[model samples]
Target chain A: MEDPRNRQYTNDEITVFWKPAKCVHATTCFRELIEVFNPGRRPWVDMSAASTQRIIEVTDKCPTDAIVWKYNKDLSENELQASTSTSEEVNPETLSTDPETKPAKVTIMKDGPIVVEGEFKVIDSNGNELKSMIMTSFCRCGGSHSMPYCDGRHRKIGFNDKK
Target chain B: MKEKSAQFRVIENKSLEVSGSFEIFNAKGELLKSEGPIYLCRCGLSENKPFCDGKHKNSGFTG
Candidate 1:
């Protein structure tokens, strides 16, 4: 079966593949190019939002090779068709709402919170919402008093990005 | 029996308390411990390392 999470984003010139299984969630892609690789958005990648060269530059920074790209001219007929079909189905807003389409992947942020996506239950010490986040950061710096949810305190206290 | 989700609690500005089914590993990916409500230092000044020894109060850690 084709892996649902193994997705591709294509512009008119090139296509970028996102293998969620290979992602370490170093946050390099989104941190460097939020306009194109926004984690908060469904489908999580917008190939048309940025230039092909810029997307390639950011994709190179992905430590795990989770994001890779190729020119559209290099693709086979089947690949070209698949890329077009995928783009037609691309709706960043509705991608994750269907539980069957995407299983949650927990991304260990570099010296930050555990960013969880897809479907999962999060409970606090008192079992509160702390907040039900689709893509939320959990404190790994051991600094957040809010427990699982990040309060952006890591930046205030100088939490080391390398742990 | 099902495994319980991991738990983490912040002891004010002192330390972070972690416990449950989750595992804590070092940079080398070695398993640290399972039974711990491990108290990890948040003050960024722990000499004992990872664990807290009431240094937050002395260091004036506001986190």
Candidate 2:
């Protein structure tokens, strides 16, 4: 059975498949190629932002098989035709926002700050705005000495989140 | 319904402010940070770990 949740995108040379269920939010895609894998952008995958080679390289780095790619030449005729038709019809606005606004998913790094995603607001202790970031890390180690934001001190202090 | 983007505010010498649709999990994958308006320690001096405990004031943490 076909899962409607699975999506794919392609340029003239290659096709990129997205399996959201497998995503661990490791952020490798966006961090490596924000121009193409910007989570802030709808559809979140812009195949045209980079060359097919670069896209393939980054896609391979995905820790999970959440994202995968294949050469257009390798796809069957039916797949090639589907790629073209669907690629052109993509509308950024049609993409889901925050998976229905449930809440931002926060992942605490093994030795780093907390990585926050989705919809949320961060205010200072006194109620001032520092910066609104789509994805940001907050200090968890008691050694940051910064208080709220991470200063990359976790690594220095050997702060293990596993504890 | 559409979800709004999350917002984060950094304090001058205190914790970072976070609100809106978000969740905070600990290193063990536990939900240590609460949703809603929560303050996370930046100075790393909070007795509560992630939450601000005002230790920065006594420690004189400039960051």
Candidate 3:
């Protein structure tokens, strides 16, 4: 049985499937391509904002298969029917609040930023609350134009984790 | 004791000081550290990789 909450977003060429149950909120989708996967907006996934090739590129980065894509011509009959219906679409905003209050997870990506997720507070050097967010990546390469955040500069400078 | 949420503090031109309840994992999904008040390298000059080793001072990292 198809999940009632599952959503399918389509452009002229491709359709993106969203399975909320499979989303661990690793936040890879929005962080990689917010122009298409912005969680703040209604209907959340805007396939038309980006090219099919670009959308597929970011969708492949999803740690989990919460979001995946298929060509419009390849969609099965049932899937094609679901794609046309907007009445069943659910808001991604309602899924923001994490149900489990587990301690935040800080993962150190090799040759990359420190990815933090779950409930957390960020404070500047002067002890002022910077902002509270569900997920964020801190730059370890020290070359980010956006201070304290990873702007993907490590790759440009060829940062290597020797360990 | 009531467990508090994790807190991350960005030190000026230096490391990121993390405290409170949280878990830290290495690149291979291994649990590296979970205790409070840990200093992580942000200046990218640390010989110790993820941990700060006072290399920022020499590197003159201002961010």
Candidate 4:
């Protein structure tokens, strides 16, 4: 069966897999290499954006198995079958890339970072514009050295949010 | 014409201030806030969650 949350991206030399269920939202992938793992783009993982080696390096930084990759020649038969399958239901609401997408998206991931996307500006408490980004991950664990931005410290600290 | 950029403000070591056109939702895909100028907890000490509750002082939470 097709898993809606399992996404795969390819670029001849390699194929990247994204398992949302396993994601700890470390923010490592995007923060280190937004060119390839851009959350603002639909099918967020764009393998073509970087070299196979660079992609592999960033994917390796993930603290969880949320993102994985393999050489196209090394893919197992089952993986190949799953990658080629396109039977999942298409839900427009879950579509990540609609040009006219909403003003901002704040997704509080379970045990992960708060993923924010869309055009927006970040201001300091003193009314200074710190940044204007299309997408970013905010640390909810409060253990990140990057301040508001997550640095994958939640996993190390085993931070848990009360339900 | 080009539009203005959204504003996000960091309140020292306490919280993040987001303003301008934006919408916020929790992990369950529930809509929480859709308006601009919202305070998000940065110190992770908020009892109210996501939003700042001014608990950073006691928590000794720093960036």
Candidate 5:
């Protein structure tokens, strides 16, 4: 059974599943491709905004499987039935940004980047504040093209934590 | 007065300096020994693993 809060968006080729409960708000979705996943917009996901291939790329970038995609032809019977009815849309903007200050949680992913969540600030080497949302991932691998931020290059470069 | 938020500083061509209130967990989700003002390895050359072992200088890591 699907969570009542879950949402699915479909284009002619694929369907993107969104599970809000699983989101750690790593901000990868909108940060990389806001054209399709804008939190500020109603019906937050617009499958028509971008090509299916482009959409798939961004969906795969989600740190937590908060959003995932599948080919339309591969949909299960239950999924096909569910698609007949419209599901209510919920935006990340609706998710509460707690007012109270608390200790941030930083987790190091094996062979990957450093994931940080909760309240915190990011400063560059020059002491300038970098814009941050609820959460973010930092590059641990020496080869990230986007310095400081993880562009999912750790996997490509074969970073090993134990080494 | 509100407490200062935790700070993550990207030290130029070096480790990431993290300060203020925060808890760091290893890949297994076990809480690691994270005292405030810790410098985490970013160059991926640290023999110490997550913590900086000053190897970035020798490795010529420029990111």
Candidate 6:
């Protein structure tokens, strides 16, 4: 079983496992706490960047269990095996290639960008097809120089939903 | 019901033109929009919220 994408990070108190294939770019981890789960940094996740309690709080917010954490002592045999063997559990995503399933899902993140996930097509104002994607985040605070796509400008600008 | 396709058009820094059969939920999991051909605010200054109300004009809201 060749699992090159499986990455594990530890901080003596807990271990965080990452499954890249399961990531839907929900941005919860980075949006909530970027110090630990920065996508820009190589190896991408730094468990030592934050406290174990803070890391757990952000990791648990992942919509898909792409990133999961377990206490050093609480990890069961199966969890340890999870790092080496591919689990038989299948995560169902609406973005599957099934054309007859349903419409894509649009979810607004709390005080963050709008996360659009599932099968969908994007077109420019000129009606040109931009790119088809299963998951993407759109800027809601209208500060992204990248236009519609989120470039994490909302956080820099301190975008607030209420006031 | 027949399957519906989702389409999003970036309307030149004004708004996002979204169409097709879909449901939109806010951060609180509340249904925001669930219909067709709606212009969502892109300038972050919509008084009406989420939906566009032509506020992009004069807001210096460049892409």
Which candidate ranks first by DockQ, i.e. highest? Answer: 3
Residue A125's lDDT within candidate 6 is 85
- Model 2 stretches with alpha carbons more than 4 Å out: A1-24, A28-61, A65-99, A122-132, A142-151, A160-163, B1-6, B33-35
Residues B1-63, model 6: lDDT tens digits:
765678888898698888886789988888888787888877888877677899889888887
True C-alpha contacts between chains kept, each model in order? 0.03, 0.70, 0.91, 0.74, 0.90, 0.81
The DockQ-derived docking category for candidate 2 is acceptable
DockQ of 6: 0.70
Cα deviation of A133, candidate 6, in Å: 1.0
lDDT (0-100) at residue A103 of candidate 4? Answer: 71
Model 3, A24-90: lDDT tens per residue? Answer: 7777776566568765456778887778999999999988898999999999999988876656555
Native-referenced Cα lDDT, model 4: 0.71
Interface RMSD of each: 6.2, 4.0, 1.4, 2.5, 1.1, 1.3
Model 3: residues with Cα > 4 Å off, grouped in runs: A1-22, A27-57, A61-64, A70-97
DockQ of 5: 0.70
DockQ of each: 0.17, 0.44, 0.72, 0.44, 0.70, 0.70
Clashing pairs in 5: none
Cα lDDT tens digits for candidate 3, B1-63: 568889999999999999988999997899999998999999888889789889899777998
lDDT of 1 by residue, A1-163 (tens): 6556467788888888877667655666764565687654566687877789999999999899878888988987866666644433332222445434333444444444444444444544454534344444455455656543454456557777433
lDDT preference between candidates 5 and 6, better one: 5
List model 4 lDDT by residue over B12-51, tens digit each: 7787777776778787889998776778777666777777
TM-score of chain B of each: 0.84, 0.82, 0.92, 0.81, 0.87, 0.84
True contacts kept of 4: 0.74
Lowest-sum lDDT 10-residue window in model 5 chain B: B27-36
How accurate locally, in lDDT, is each candidate? Answer: 0.59, 0.65, 0.82, 0.71, 0.81, 0.74
Rank the models by TM-score, top first: 3, 6, 5, 4, 2, 1
Whole-structure CA lDDT of model 5: 0.81
- Over the true interface, candidate 2 deviates by an RMSD, in Å, of 4.0
Fnat, model 1, is 0.03
